[model samples]
Target chain A: MSTSITLLIPLLLGIGGFIVATSRARRFSDVGSGKMHSLPKYHGYLVALSIIVPAYLIIFLWLFFEQSVLRGVIVNALPDALTNGATPAQVSLLISQVQQAASGATFGNPDPAIVEVAGRLREAVVFSRWALPLVIVLVGLATAAVLVSRIAKRFRARNYSEAIMRGLLIFCATLSILATLGILLSLLFEGLQFFSRVSPIEFFFGTRWDPQIAIRPDQIGSSGAFGAIPVFMGTLTIAFTALFVAIPVGIFAAIYMAEFASPHVRGVVKPLIELLAGIPTIVYGFFAVLVISPFIREWLGSIGIAVSPTAAIVPGLVMGVMLIPFISSLSDDAITAVPQSLKDGSLGLGANRAETVTKVLLPAALPGIVGGVLLATTRAIGETMIVVMAAGLTANMTVNPLQGVTTVTVQIVALLTGDTEFDNPKTLAAFGLGLTLFLATLLLNLVAIQIVKRFREQYD
Target chain B: MMENVSFATAGAHARAPEMPVKMFGRKVEVFYGQKQALHGVDLEIPERQVTALIGPSGCGKSTFLRCLNRMNDTVAIARVVGDIRLDGEDIYDKSIDVVELRARVGMVFQKPNPFPKSIFENVAYGPRIHGLFKNKAHLQEIVETSLKRAGLFEEVKDRLDEPGTGLSGGQQQRLCIARAIAVSPEVILMDEPCSALDPIATATVEELIDELKQNYTIVIVTHSMQQAARVSQRTAMFHLGRIVEVGPTEKMFSNPDDKRTQDYITGRFG
Candidate 1:
């Protein structure tokens, strides 16, 4: 059976159960001497959930454990002569050969024992495919019959349906949290592996970052240096430059929008400003590469100062343009969150508009604004596409924005782009940089949340 | 007929030998977008006295109070027509800078809204903005005197560096009053300044208002009739966006000339 058909069987069963249960519930309401406790639609939803949940559970569980169980079965069924003293890697290799033969992609000639095992694997796959849909249909029908029989005028179907809805929401929320945790764990594990190969002291504190490891023992260059300070410094330089550009412009824009702009102008202009965020970062990347970088180079050259075409300022400035809406929108929310009574108090005290905003409104809104700036900083730190397209590949420890410097994200991309063995320190170094970036961003987010929480406590 | 009677009382009050008009409104009408909020309100605020505007909710008393300082200019849709004068100068004239006018006519709002700054900073903000001091000591003197005048200095002087928002509700209101006084405005407009306060706090504020009127002309809007009778010398009763009566506070409460005022004072209908 095809995968789509297998999926469709349970869906069709659920829809059929819905229709049947709905009509039955309607009939119960008509015959009973009281009003239905739950709506007929809720009854339909309850029946549908009963059918779909159990059926999909079985299908997913079967699919999840099928491959490993099949591999175990094949390993167990192999003759003692073939498996007796083989290492796990050799056994895994033999299993792949068997799978290749099973899929009719075998090369040259094959041994009789291996060919027999391949035949058995093929038969098992076919049987499992057919068995899955059969079992799903049986479970769906069984659950549908059980739930439909229990539907009554006073069944309280809405409660059951709502419970299922709540479970679904919890499941979605947990799924995202679990995904984040999974990424963190994977980064930690791989980063640990990288550290095992390269000392943590050298990786963290060393000022040089060269991840190119010689493939051969006698290669021209020595082994790669994984000092992350330069990359971290590059990231900081660009992020700070971006903030330098973004903070003043974004804050002024927010102030103007929140305090000075008329409602008619704000309604039109706010969305137009926010539209800057909607432009994809990748588009911003190319815009930086194709437009800003060369312009900076030419403009600087004319001023009798030399600058790289991929100077840190190019992507830094462009990313700031990209972040303008982000900072402005968040800042606008913070500014607008300030109570009008404060503004009135200041104005009533004979302060002018600018005086009120600077002396009263800004101080009151400082925590919220700081939180927003921190969030934007994290965004600038983690921004990849613009850095990748417009930043240099070399990690240089320079404070000058006119020079080219590579960030952790750019280096991570450079390290992992082509074919490479995962076990090598070169590839594992990407994980190390990733963990570093993640920790930095996580720290920033925690601080931002703390500041924002304090701001809320002030108002509430 | 009711308008004529209210005008006659206002005229009589304005002609009183001891009291001089500080702020006057002549047929002041306020419109918010297309909705008319105040209709031809005529009232006079006497110098060094508390004039209370008394009405039920949505009666436009606060509207008329805000019109005294042109605080209505802050509301985008609010439009004020007719003449409102401060010390016999037309306040709505383009030549009269609103900022300077506000410095001469300060306001206190219904809620206690102190700047999220230290107690000292909150009181000093007005002086700092207006450049009212020659030195830091002068600024400090202004702050101390303002706080003392608002009767908050004795309570808050120990924690002058603490955030003003951390003060109790009543203290915060007093802090706001101190802030308003720091600039030394001639007239003060208070819009239900004690509504958000407790009874004890309200009493303290009412007493402070009585004392403040000796130096500053005060116009207050209050929902509580008892609060009006207790704090104000002259009272104006607003109903349905128009003044039904204007007279001495004791007469308005005891023997109002208009039936609406009589009914309102006796709790027949608001």
Candidate 2:
């Protein structure tokens, strides 16, 4: 039978089971004076689920293990002369040829032993597909019929259904956690591989970052230094410059919006400012390269200072503009959360509006404002598309914003772009960089959380 | 330094002999948007005395007291009509700066709202903003004196640098009173200041209010008639956006002229 027809079998059983369960419940009600413990619909759902869930599980687990089990049995049955000394790769290739032969693809002249095995493989696949749905139908119908026979008024169908639902929700939550753990562990293992090739001390503190590897035995003058100081310095300079532009502007805008603007103006203006965050980063990168770099270069050239078009400031300024909405939105919430009685106290004491804001509201909102600024700094450090496009890949260690620099994310992208061998130290270094960057950001976030917690406890 | 009034002569105010009026209101009315919150009412607050406004909830007593210092100006839709004078000067005139008016007429809120700062800073906030001191030493002197006057210095003197919010409920209310007195305002208004406290804290604040009556003309809005009788020398009863009666605290509590005031104070009906 076809797979769709096999799948429809359980669906039809579920419909038939619903009718049987509901009719049985109604029939049992007529024979007894006792009331039903649950509504008839719950009994119908229980019967239907008993049919579909077990049938689907049988089909799923059979499909998961069918191919590997078949492959292993066929490979073991092959002639020992061809398989005794073959490497794992050759064995894999040989298995594919046998499968292709069974599918009638023209690959090579088939040995007689291989031809026999391919024929057996075709028959086994045909038998397996048909056999699975037969067992599924029998098992599913039995479960549904049994569930209908056992459907009493006291069966807790709703509890069972809700427990299943809760289980599904937990499964979904664990899936995401598993995905994150998988990525982190992969980065850790690959970083260990890279460290085996190059010392970790040199990778962290060395000033040179030449990731070249010699191809020939006699090749000379490719040291492959892998010093990450210049890259770290570049990341810091761009992030600091971004903060220099973002923190003051974002905080001031937030203060004005929360404290000064009337409700009507604030409603219109706040969403407009938050709209900056909704724009895609690639579009911002395009604008940075096309607009801001030229503007900065021309303005600086008039002052007799030669600067590169791809200077770090171009990306840093653009990223800062991108970050303004984050800081402003969070800080606005923080400032607005302050109790109004404090303002009344200040004003009743003859303090002016400016004094009330500076002396009462700002100090009360400091911890949350610091939280906003720290979050914006993390985004600045991890920003990639703008840095990759506008901040050039030259890892210059200079503090001047006019010089070109590259961040860790930018280098990670550059390192992973092309088809490259994973065994080489140069390719492995990306994972090392990724792990280091993740750890650094994690440390920063922990410290920020501590500060915010301490400050909040002090005031509130 | 000043002397306290003896309780032996407290009943003298209940008689027909007239005392001088400090702030006078003639035909005062208040409206919030289209809704009238205060009727056309005439009343007088005596000089250097505690006048308690007693009424049930939503009687407009708080509204009438807020009109004394133009605090109603903060509500955008609120409108006041008629003349209310402070020391015989019209306070609602356009030339009267509201900040200076508030400086002369300080207020303590229903809830203890101390700024998130040290106890010393909480008291010194008024003097710092007004530039009332010649130096740091003078400012410290003013803070200590205000705290002492508010009866808070004995409890919080050792932890002057600690946050005022960390203090107990009654201590925080006393700190707020010190905050108000630090600026040396002539008249102080309190709106249900002891409502958010326990019985012990309420008794302490009532005692403090009576002592504060020595130097400041105080107008307090209260829900408890017993509290008004305990601390106030003069009492005014408000009901349904109008002042029902005004007289000495003893006469108002013992034998009110108006049926509404008599019902409210005698626990007949509010």
Candidate 3:
């Protein structure tokens, strides 16, 4: 049987169980002296889940281990002459050749021994596919019969269904947390390999960041430097530039939306501002390279100042534009969240709107606003595409916006892009950079959460 | 219809001894969106005395109170038609600045809404915004006298720099009152000011209101007949957006001209 057909048998059984169990539970409720503990539909759901859950679990487990277990069986059944002294890679290649021969798509003339093994592998695969669905159908029928027989007037079907629902929700939650932990562990392991090759002290505190290892000993700049301070500084400079552009404009926009603008005007304008956030970051990268970078160079040149075409300010300005809606939307929420009573108290004291906003609303909403700004700061730090297109690749340790700079994200992309050897220090260094970036943003998010928590406590 | 006519003339009957009217409302009507909240509300607020507006919920008592300082303007859909005058100057005139009008007439809300600032700063905010002080010391002196007048100076003197929101409910209300007083307004409007307070806090605030009437023209809106009777000299009873009766507080509670006022105050029906 095909995999889809195999899966369909459990679904059909579940539906059949549901119909049978529902009618049985309804009969019990109608004929019994006492009331049924749960509704008939809950009984239907309980039986359906009991059949489907275990059947799906078995099918998934069988499918997950089927290929490896089949390969092990095929390898053991092979003669010693065909498999002796073979590396694991060669054995894997030989297995693929056999699988190809079984599928009737052999690339070249095959060995007679391989053809014999391929016939056995084909028989096993066919037997396994048929056995899985037969086993699932039997399990489903057994569970349905047992559960349907156990149904009574006082059966706690609702509690069982509720427990199943809670387990599903917990599984979803645990799945996401485990995925995050998996990524962190992978990064740590790869980063450890990189750190073993490069000293951590030099990687963190040293200023230079040239990661190029010469192919030949005679090559110029042969010894690669791994200092990350310059790269970190560059990241800080660009992020600060973005914040400098985003903060005031974003806050003013928020205040205008929250306090001054009419409902009609706010309704029209807020979505237009948030639309800026919907544009892809790569498009912002293009805008940085084609529009902002040239504009900055020309504008500064007109004022008799020199600047690189791909200056830090290029991507910084575009990233700031990207972050505007982020900061403003969050800040607008924070400002609007301030109690209207406080605004009334201020205005009742004869304070104008400006005084009321500055003296009352801003202070009350300060923590939430700070949290929003910090979140935007992390976004600016982690941004990659725009910097890749507009920022220079050189890790310049400078605060001047007119100079070229590189960031950690840009360096990670540069390191890991193209065909790479897994064991090389250069490729592994991307994991180190990724881990650092992750830590930095994680610390920032924690602080933002703390601030937002305090802010919520203040009012609620 | 006849009852409307009879109650409309009730404000002209049972008048108390003559006193200076600080605020005059002539046929004041308030509308929020399309719904009319107050209809032709005619009343007089005597200078340096508490004029209590007593009614059940949604009877336009609080609406009329907010109209005193033009606080209703903050609600975008709220509209007021008619004349409200402070010291013979029409407060709703196009020439009037709302900031200046609010400075002359302050208000206290039902909920205690002290700014999330220091205790000292909360009171000093008004003086600083209105430039009511010459120097830091003068500002400090104004804050001190305002807090003292609100009867909160002794309690909060040791924690002038602490957040005003950290105070007790009654203390925060008093702090808001002191904030209003710091600007030295001519009139003060209170909208169910003790509704959020415990009995002890309510009594304290009521005593404070009694003391406050000697210096400022006070208009208070309350649901409790006992509160109006205890704290007010002049009382106006509003029912269905019109004045049912306006006279001395004693006569209104004792022998109200309108049946609605009697029904409201006598616990028959509101």
Q: Chain A TM-scores, all candidates?
A: 0.86, 0.83, 0.94
Clashing pairs for model 1 are none
Better of 1 and 2 by DockQ: 1
lDDT string, candidate 1, B166-256, tens digits = 9999999999999998999999899999999999999899889978977999899998877787777899999989998998886787678
Tell me the spans in candidate 2 whose CA falls farther than 4 Å from its real position: A1-87, A90-165, A449-460, B1-19, B25-34, B73-82
Docking class of 3: high
Q: CAPRI verdict on model 1?
A: medium
A1-460 per-residue lDDT for model 1 (tens digits): 9878998888898899999988888886354555888878899999898888778888899999999989987897678899999999999989998999899998899878888999889889999999999998888888888888898767888999899889989999999999999999999999999999999999999998888888988889868999999999899999999999999999999999999999999999999999998999999999999999888888889999999876899999999998888788888888888999999888887788999888878888889899989999999999999999999999898978999899999999999998979988999999999999999999999999999899988888
lDDT of 2: 0.86
Residues A1-460, model 3: lDDT tens digits: 9998988988888899999999988886354454778888889999999998889999999999999999997898778987899998988888898888889988778988889999999999999988999899888889999999999888899999889888889989999999999999999999999999999999999988998886667887647888999899889989999999899989999999999999999999999999999999999999999888778888989999999876888888899999999889989999999999999999998889999898889988999999999999999999998898888889888888889999999999999889888787788888889989999999999999999889998888
CAPRI-style grade of the A/B interface in model 2: medium
TM-score: which candidate is best?
A: 3
lDDT of 1: 0.89
DockQ of 1: 0.74
* Ordering by TM-score: 3, 1, 2
Q: Which stretches of candidate 3 lie over 4 Å from their true place?
A: A29-35, A77-79, A215-221, B1-17
Error of 1 at A390 (Å): 1.2
